[model samples]
Target: MHLLGRKSKKMAPLFLALVVSLMTFALAVPAIQLNAQKLGEGSTTIQSPAGKGAVNFVLDNNNPDNLIGVTVSFNETLPAGSIIYVKLYNGGTLVTSASKQLTADLSAGSGIEIDFTSAVPISDFDRVAVVVKGPTIQP
Candidate 1:
């Protein structure tokens, strides 16, 4: 009778451990499925231009008819009389271009915002590229 009682006590812990492991596996299964669904989306990468400046901007879908618009911001400390040129391109074609000249003394982290819209339908293009050229920054 004493040997039988010891064997029964050992079996109790073994049963409890098995039940706990199964519960943990059940809870983790749904979280794994949710993360797998998010992996299908795509992302965009922006390349900084030449010179010693930084361009930080956001692309927003403004018009319902045209699905693309870009807002550009630049930070640079340029001399009082410096000229900067900005260009936008869709594939190999030039879409829009702009230039600016600084009047007063500018700071190193100073920036400006510009918006560009497409004349033709945005859906016609597969990829879009924006290029900047000037004395201060490039992105």
Candidate 2:
């Protein structure tokens, strides 16, 4: 047992030196930061012709993140009691959808932002289409 203690004491200094070297490396090294650059034209917009009931806009966000929201607009004041649907699609398959009811106070030619925060996993080169369904857009 005494011989074992002597051996352990001899190894302790080596272990302590290794630990100190690791600690110094950890403290001396600087942290690396990463960030994603959003594209200048990160969104898509489409104008619905008169008498058309829907406006289809395809946004090929060949980007790093899935679409988060959309801003819809009507050439004229949205009809009262209008039911607008915001549909998201990927490669002809429907992913998710959202809806908004037009109020009297909503002005014409203004944008209606819809949030689709819960979207499917989107990768690069993914084709995401946003279809806005509603009455004809007066223009």
Candidate 3:
């Protein structure tokens, strides 16, 4: 019984060391940050003449990030050949616009990202707008 007690004492240190190593590994793991950008244009849900979806706008911080893109999440599938228009506006005037036509049917609740063909500076616009020219549906 004493021999068994000594063996358990020895095993306690190994167990403690294993626990410490696992804790250290857990602490060393880096955090996951999604779309870690410098600035964001906020998000909103909009009902379009063609369809409905939630839009998230992201602004370029020029942290080598000169590209602007729009993320849209619909409650239903968006059919192929549907066109999504993303526009930048300065006051009442339109600064620039980018668009993409859906190549395949986008699944419901799945978000789609449409990026500008070329770099468009965020400094040129204060307002962002999205217009969908496709099917009429509710979000």
Candidate 4:
């Protein structure tokens, strides 16, 4: 009878431990699935029209190295003889600037690509803002 009591105590603790472990796992699986769902898979694209305005691009550690490329797609036709100016700023300081003249009316879905390479390392930047200015379009 003493041996039976000892065995019951040992088994009781083991069963309690197993129950706790299963409860923990059961509670954790839903959280893991929710996090996975939040990290939705895909790329995001933005389209804008031609106008004199500014667009800000936020850069983080995840940005590509050596080259930062931005493609602006126009939603409508721009005015004639207009020009687009692209400027890159890091932490309130101007880093690089470029411009392209509008030869033909910017077609819907057609846009410009602005590339920045000469700026300081992304590690040195806390934030990056791209300002696009033109006749009618503002990014």
Which candidate leads in lDDT? Answer: 3
In the range 78-110, model 1's lDDT, one tens digit per residue, is: 555555565655777766655556575556666
Any residue pairs clashing in model 3, and if so which?
Answer: none
lDDT of 4 by residue, 1-65 (tens): 37558778879988999999999999888543443445445766644444333343423346444
Arrange candidates by lDDT, descending. 3, 2, 4, 1
- Judge candidate 3 at residue 21 and give its lDDT: 100
Give candidate 3 misplaced runs (Cα > 4 Å). 1-51, 58-67, 135-139
- Count of clashing residue pairs in every prediction: 1, 0, 0, 9
- lDDT by residue (tens digit), candidate 2, 20-57: 99999999999999997975555677544323232433
TM-score of 1: 0.37
Residue 115 of model 1, lDDT score? 45
Report the poorest 10 consecutive residues by lDDT, candidate 2: 49-58
Candidate 2: TM-score? 0.42
True-structure lDDT of candidate 3:
0.75
Error of 4 at 130 (Å): 5.8
Candidate 2, residue 113: the lDDT equals 68
Name the weakest run of 10 consecutive residues (lDDT summed) in model 4. 51-60
Judging by TM-score against the true structure, name the best candidate.
3
TM-score of each: 0.37, 0.42, 0.51, 0.40
